[model samples]
Structures are given as structure tokens and as C-alpha cells.
Target: MNLAHAAPAAVDEGMTCTVADGWWSLDPERPSQPEPVKVVKLKSLTTGEPGVWVQPARGKLTDQQMHIALRRLSDCH
Candidate 1:
């Protein structure tokens, strides 16, 4: 699946998700903290014209982190 550019969904509500071990951690108390990866999916809220929305997420993830996550997800397919 080409996630780089996907057909935008509608402008509805968004959501959040976490990817375990997505980021590096050092705190022993929170060894599994990894990082909080937010996943947003836009849904059309209006009618007519297929809603062209943007679903983006940002957390403790950097460009490299995001690339790695996307690569990992792609590898699953």
C-alpha cells in the first residue's frame, strides 16, 4: 500500500493509536515508554465534493522515527 499519498478520507472525527517499541527509551521505570505515535484519519463532514482531508499525527516521533514506523508497517504486508 502506498501510504506516502493516499486518497484523503472525509472530514470526520480523528483518533489516536500507539506503536510499541516505535521509539527508543532509557527510563527504567518506563522502559517500554518507547514513544507515543498518534494516528489521525480524517473523515468527510460535508456533502458533495469528496471531502479532501488531511490525517496526520505527531508525537515524540521525528522524521527518522516516522520513516522506520512506516517501513515496519509496510513490511507487514
Candidate 2:
């Protein structure tokens, strides 16, 4: 939750995240599109680390969109 030192550009390969709340609108600039999902980093099943990854929630996103969201979330903190 305290991602003050989290890097926004970190790789999300070995990371896992959970949606903290419902999906939110991305930016007000584009009202037509739904908001990106909000999520919190969860413990990595591979590395056993926690709070190291943060990215937009997945599931609804396509492969490309999920990739992009993962990258964006990496920079969230």
C-alpha cells in the first residue's frame, strides 16, 4: 500500500496483483473509454515477495492491453 519507493518502470514479469477495488475510469481526458482497473501488488508466487509490483487490474484487458497496463502499473508508485 505504501509504494512511496516503488519504481513505476519496473518489470512486471514475476509479479502478481489483486484488484483493490472496482475498475475505475482511466483519465478524464477520454470519457468514452472506461477507466483502467485499480489494483494492488500481491505476493509473487515465484519470488515470494510482496508489495513490489503494482499495475492495472487484468482479466478484462486483451493481451496487448494487459501488457501495457502491467507496464503502467509498474510505474504506479
Candidate 3:
């Protein structure tokens, strides 16, 4: 899948995630931390809307993480 745009789910970038490793690391202390290389996708809850993309990085996210992400994405409207 093509990512329209994606950055680290990081505080420095103004985003926060609870995951430690993977793309969810938002800890500003580990500024050198890297997001996964393959895409971690968060499926859409609404019809006709594209899934929220994590980028060209791949990793596992908890169910709660997905829910939070989807909810946040929905708020963009």
C-alpha cells in the first residue's frame, strides 16, 4: 500500500503511542529510535474511508493501540 504521508508515531512529531518498540514508540528520550521498515496498517472502522497508515514500516500493535489510532484518525474529520 502507498502511504500518503507517515512519520514516527512520536512526541517530537507531535504524536503519541503506547507501544515500546515498533512504530508506536513516542518516547522523546529515544529520538534515535526507528520505526519498522514495513507498513503497520490500522484498518478503518468507517465505510468508504481508507485505512489509517503507519507508513513503509511493519510491526505489531496491540488491539488498544489500533483502536486509539483509528479513533484518532476519525477525529481528523
lDDT of 1 by residue, 1-77 (tens): 84343322322323333344543544556755534433333333344322222222343333322222222221110
All models, RMSD in angstroms: 10.7, 10.2, 12.0
Model 2 segments more than 4 A misplaced: 1-12, 22-58, 64-77
Which window of 10 residues has the lowest lDDT sum in candidate 2? 62-71
* Best of the two (1, 3) by TM-score: 1
Model 3 error, position 32 (Å): 10
Question: lDDT of each prediction vs. the true structure?
Answer: 0.33, 0.36, 0.36
Per-residue lDDT tens digits for candidate 3, residues 4-75, read 434233222223332234435455566435443222555554663344443422333433323223323211
Candidate with best TM-score: 1
Model 1's C-alpha root-mean-square deviation from the true structure amounts to: 10.7
Error of 2 at 52 (Å): 9.3
CA lDDT of 59 in candidate 2? 40
Question: Alpha-carbon error at 44 in model 3, in Å?
Answer: 3.5
lDDT of 2 by residue, 25-76 (tens): 3444543343333343333434333333334443434232222223234222
Model 2 Cα RMSD, Å?
10.2
Backbone clash pairs for candidate 3 read: 37-57, 38-57, 38-58, 39-57
In model 1, what lDDT does residue 42 have? 31
Give Cα distance to truth, residue 35, candidate 2, Å. 14
